[model samples]
Structures are given as C-alpha cells and as structure tokens.
Target: MNKIAIVYGSSTGATEAVAEKLQSALGDADLFNAESVNIDDLKPYDFLIFGASTTGIGDLQDDWEMLLPKMEKMDFSGKKVALFSLGDSASFSTSFAGAMYHLYKALKGKVEIVGSVSADGYNFDESDAIVDGHFVGLALDEDNEYNETDKRIAVWVENLKQYLN
Candidate 1:
C-alpha cells in the first residue's frame, strides 16, 4: 500500500474539512497542517496530497506561502503528488483555485503530478489552475457549491487511487 500524506493550509476550515474527508476515504493516510509539517517529513510518503484555499486574487493561503519555498527545495523524485483547493467560484470566477496552480508550478518538474480533474462540471470564467484544458487538481467551490463538496471529494479520491500504483 502506498503511504499517503495529506497536508493542507486552511484559513476558514473549508479546505481542512475536505482534507479530513479524504483521510476518511483513504484509510491509513496521515494528515498534517502545512504550518506544522516539516518539508523533510514528506520524504517518507509515497504520495502527497496538498490542499489549500485561495486568497486575494490568486494568492495561496498564508501558511502555504511560508511552506512553499521549503517544498520547492525538497526532492520529490519518486513521489506522486495530487492537489485540491477551495475557492469562491461565484465571486472569484476568473481566478478560481489559483493556489493549486501555484503549487503545481512549484512542484511540477520535481514530482509526478497526478489526479488532474476535468473542468467539465465547473462554472468558472477563467482559472490559472487549468492546464491542457483540465483543472490541475480537484477544484472545490465551497462558498457557492458547498453541497457538491462531499461527492466531488469521493470521486476525486477514487480517481487518485489509480495513479498511486
């Protein structure tokens, strides 16, 4: 079984809720707050899932900002990484889930990025999170489509399992 680690930076608890749901869905996974986890600690995990809530106009959550530089310096050569993020798609439609894109950029060449979710069901005007016409990871709009979060997470987690092996 792949050793998985879920690390998140949440300001309003929405992202944390999704992280907890993922932990429940993926049995035996470990969870960590981005502020408290050391970058070196991630080296042991076979798979890394990062969750963050986008703030301002496409900026990463505050805690993620501090940890990102450290993450960039770490070697993720044999690991697979997936990302999830919370954003207000209704209000911030243009830059929805931008933080995930930022994180993707930081780790792109270093890790084998996995779980790119389709953008078909999302209602966004534009997003940095989109690459090759798909969201770089699971994109959640808890502010507007809160009711869909659980289902979305369940599906994304299932999809992620395929990439882990």
Candidate 2:
C-alpha cells in the first residue's frame, strides 16, 4: 500500500497545484480531490496529507468545510495525517492559513497528525494555524510567496520521509 494520501480542496486551484506538487515530490502517494474523496479511498493509506485554501476572514474552503463532519467521525486511531494550507499571507496576514486550525482540531485526538512545520520563515503577523510555536502542518503562502513553495515542499517532504519509512 502507498504510505500516504494527499487530499485537497481548492476553490481556485491553488491548493490543488500544491497537492500535485506534493505527490510529485513524494513520488509514491495517492492524490485525491476533496470533493470526491471517500473512506474507501483513504482506508489503504496509513498517512494522509490534507490541503486546503483559507477563504474570507479565515473560513475553511467550501469542499473541506463540507468534509469535516465526515472526517471527524472516522476512526483514524492508527493513522498519521498532515496538512498543507494555501492562503494569502500578504493580504491576510492576521489570518494566514487560519482554516488549517479547524482541520487540525477535527483530527487532533483521533489521529496522530504529523509534519508540524516551524513558524520561523513565515512573514504573517498571526495565524490560527499556529499551535504553540509551530504550524499544525506545512503552511504555504502560494498566493503571496509562490516562489518559496518549492523549497518549503521539498523540506517538508524530506522531513516527512522520516515518519513514512
């Protein structure tokens, strides 16, 4: 079985682009769009990577918002999940990648979510996604700092391999 499942919800394709890149970088994970994802599609993988874009004032994007209740109900006890968020840090510094906060909450005690990235390189003023001194997952400012995404993903994937293998 593949070790990871990279799922994403995107309104304007930014998050999907990141998902694609993550699959390319990892080279061995399954990618699923949030709109059509089902438990069966996820059952084979022990690791999951969820990606979504932050919407108005830090709200979760539509497809991911709709998927939350279902995700919360799943038995993810033995699974490890990660998150990647896409938001405009420059325009919404106060709420950069904040929607990831909800996703993290839904899976917190249920799943062993991994890949908490350090908050060091981000230029945002604040983020709901921040837990203590780190992001809940790999946070990406694709709308504002697109150039950094490649480096960020490469580093995150490298760190992620430690958990996967």
Candidates' TM-scores?
A: 0.96, 0.96
Candidate 1 lDDT by residue in tens digits, 19-83: 99889998879999998999888889999999999999988999999999987678787789999
Candidate 2 Cα outliers beyond 4 Å, as residue runs:
none
Model 1: worst 10 consecutive residues (lDDT sum): 70-79
How many residue pairs clash (N, CA or C atoms closer than 3 angstroms) in each of the candidate models, in the order given?
0, 0
**Model 2 worst lDDT run, 10 consecutive residues:** 70-79
- List model 2 lDDT by residue over 1-165, tens digit each: 437899899999989989999999999988898898986788878899998999989888899998888876687767888888888988999999988888998888888888999998789898999998999999998777889999999999999887786
How much does candidate 2 score in TM-score? 0.96
Candidate 2 whole-model C-alpha lDDT, 0 to 1: 0.88
Q: Model 2, clash count?
A: 0
